[model samples]
Target: MSAPRFALGATVRIAERTPPVHHRVPSYAKGQVGRIVRVCHEHGLPEAYIRGDGRPFQRLYRVRLDQKALWRDYAGAAGDTLDIEIFEPWLEPAE
Candidate 1:
């Protein structure tokens, strides 16, 4: 499928789905929205590398999400945020 490539500061949501095989997205980040801060170069899927099959390639990104948005109970500063390096397949345009 031709997924739209997001620009810097674009809003995106981590896919809330679970793949049958091993994946990189964390359970806590799923279904959450974040902003794309960096568009990383293409790389072999980490799961495939873990399986000794480093063949698949995809784009990666550094996404920034507000801490409070991610955790309702977050007690840190309102400006606090988290950055995650997520593969493109696990991301979707924020609806």
Candidate 2:
């Protein structure tokens, strides 16, 4: 319920965390650098919802990442990118 931690166009990196439960983010995306393209919504945390924690709220963002950065075997165009919606907790300012 606080102000968003990141603004649009901000560069961020997905946190490389491996929790015991499955996270919405794909494993290949961990540690990837991306830009915050859109702010989605304040929504319930999936982990909390499943645990019957009554659901905590958090900001969600759409992150745009270079496709090549995601796969070593990527043969797509240089401009190719992938946009993924991720919760704020999964992101950090890019180093």
| Reference-based TM-score, model 2 | 0.91
| Model 1 Cα shift for residue 49 (angstroms) | 4.9
Best by lDDT: 2
Deviation in Å, model 1, residue 46 alpha carbon: 3.1
Question: Candidate 2 residues 1-95, lDDT tens each?
Answer: 77999999999999998888756888888999999999888887676666776367889999999988888999989899999988999999984
In terms of lDDT, model 2 sits at: 0.88
Give me candidate 1's TM-score against the actual structure.
0.84
State the C-alpha lDDT per candidate.
0.86, 0.88
> What's the distance in Å from true for residue 62, model 1?
0.5
Clashes (backbone N, CA, C under 3 Å), per candidate, total 0, 0
Lowest summed-lDDT stretch of 10 residues in model 1?
A: 1-10
What's model 1's lDDT at 89? 78
